[model samples]
Target: MSKQSEDLLPLWTLSTTETELPLSLTEPMTPSRLTELRAVLAALAESPIATLEAHPLSAPADTSKGISLGRMSPLAQELATLAAQSTRSVPKAAGNSGEVLYRMVVPAKVAAEVSGGVLEPMISKAVPGGVRSALVGTNGISAHASFVPATAGAAGGSAATVGVAAAGAGALTVAAPLVLLAVAAGASAHADHKRQLEIEKITALLEKLHEDRLDDERNRLDGCRSAIDKATAILLDKGKIGLSLGLDTAVHTIDTALASAQRRITDWRAALEKLPPDKVELRQLNDAIAGIESPGSEFYVHLELAELAIALKRRVIVLQAVEHAQQDDGNPFESFTNSINLDAQNLEKIVTGLRDVLLRLSTLQLDRSHGMRDFTFSSGAVDKLLNTSHRLRALGDRVEAGRSQSDVAIEMVQKVDGSIVVLPAMAAE
Candidate 1:
């Protein structure tokens, strides 16, 4: 099956994530203060206002495009409503996990805002007392800022050292673009290599399909040989003129079916040969091969019908001969016989059945030409095609075949009186 293309997340779509925040107090935490902190955190988390944002997965949305993830389309809102009904939430930690984890639903814009600096001020204002130093963690959407109490006053030189370190980080940030460019190039090359490997795999599968078809043809030939053997055995055991006629008819039918099947296979291969390897898409090639609906499977059906019809004709001839002799009729018994007995309802039933089977065979349209018969450059394309094809063609027995009509014919012949097996006038000398 073909590989499917990845669905990239829409940058305009609103996304929500839960955040865990740690809180530190300048003084021992009072219950009232904690309550105030929780309220401020929840408000800031849910608010679309310019609260600090950070997203783990994506770059910030380009407001220039006028795409707002927060605004849902009508269809999206309906889908969200349906999804919400079925959505289940995991139980969060019971005891104090030291960090405060709160759920938030914010626009993509707020999620992309970086965490550290903007959060400290927000926490200071939200809490009763100002936060001295804070370590803010966000679900990347909402601030999960942890407030830390300010330590005893640091020596004046410490500020200077910290500023120098910040400057060094700025220098590294300037070089990030160059590093990212090199990584992108590497990724592109790897993707190309992967695609090439998939193409090679498809080529191998086509070759295997051809080989398998040849093997199937050989198997069909073997089955024909078996049918011939069974006919020979029947001729020996019964030594009836009907058996000989049935055998001959079966052989002719087998040959005809094989010829028809071969012609189809030839046509299929010819179509493929016309397609230049470079121009042919892997999917097209697979479809062409699959499009071939060979009558190879009908070989047994035709052979069985031919044999049965002939055997039944023999019985009817003998029966008529008996009736003619008893009535002292002068007409040749051969003239009265038919491929199906006229006097009995069984022949009509058998003929009707054969007609139905033939009708089915005639209507047998196979869309075997599957687009997803092999993997291609897009790995998921084949799989997607395979699934669709399966759903579309999921009915009836694919192996076109018919039951053994010869058995029914033989059974009927056995019921006839053996004493009436006298040589017909034509076979007399």
Candidate 2:
């Protein structure tokens, strides 16, 4: 796998280089073997050096009866492959070819379980309360600590700190106490440096992810604003033909609201640029980002209101046409009445849904400390559009009622001379 793929996978280097597999891994796939593996993993989860030392696998060193790589399960096969790769990569001393190296690739589910259950808790316990909060609280960013162990020679030569001869019983070779202390200090320093590098890597990844999300939100906002502008322009054109009713005032309100929202977004972008390189400042930034209006909510509401305005404007035009047609003699008014009634019904439904959206907006819990109010729609603009819808609906109702009453009073009649006359229904009767 590529380096990126390896980083995504949960991989561990085995503590020992053994060509023959341990019974825990080589044993037949059973519940017992699974239990044993889990136990071993739990023990090794904290250490950079993953070893079966002092465990049950330490005994039974006979390699002759061990299972071959082909006979193992898929999981074991992968582990064996990794082990072979490790053995080949590590440098070997002369005449010490018996030493082997191993690595293991754990399943994703098991990795997550171990990370959350074992690793995170261990980290939480190890760090100070303040540092822990800075690392994992409210920011929605998690720290995944990875450790790389110091390499050991292929021979049973001493590892980084100590060396043992392979031919003899493993006897302790103690260096001077001062020398041991110096080695311990150097290792500690190296561990700290490695940890710092890992932290930087994780931080960079999270920053890129956050930037991508922000870019998407900005694009959506721009699209919505463009839609609202187009709709407003169409409405203004329609108004020029003498059908306008309080349109300029409503449009002005919408423009003002949109401008305010745009300014707020610009301010947020600026804030992102000027963030100080301090822990507390970063945490505050995270909180502010979280408080941002849910992606596109601010502009989406305005876009909906703009659509409703255009639809209502069209209905008003229809009403004017109907009035002009009514001035002529004996024109059928049934279609006009039905059309007006339908418009009224549809307008009511649209207005109700818009009102519901406004209600939801009002209920959003924006943090005033973060200046989130500027990112929301203006109340004045929303109210004006809603009130206009109500007026249009009322106008439609009056037109429909007047036309129906007029129809009832007029009747078409054919007299003895065979000429048709339209007169009051009472006179015709």
Best by lDDT: 2
Which regions of candidate 2 fall more than 4 Å away from where they truly are? 1-13, 16-26, 44-429
How big is the RMSD of model 2? 35.8
Distance from true location, Cα of 423 in model 2, Å: 87
Q: For candidate 2, write residues 1-429 as lDDT tens digits.
A: 101111111112232112221222211222223334434544444321122100011111222211122213222333233333334222221013332212122222222211111111112232211111112333332332222222232333443311212222221112111111111122222222222333344334434445554344333332333333233333222222232344344334434434444444444445544544332222343444443232223333333223324232332423333433234323312233344445445444443444333332333322222345647656764554454334323323312111111001111121122222211111000
- Clash count for each candidate, listed in order shown: 19, 4
Residue-level lDDT of model 1, residues 97-197, one tens digit each, is 21111111212222212110111111123222211111122322222222211111111212121112212211001111111111111122222222233
lDDT of all predictions: 0.26, 0.28
Q: What is the alpha-carbon lDDT of model 1 when measured against the actual structure?
A: 0.26
TM-score of each: 0.18, 0.17
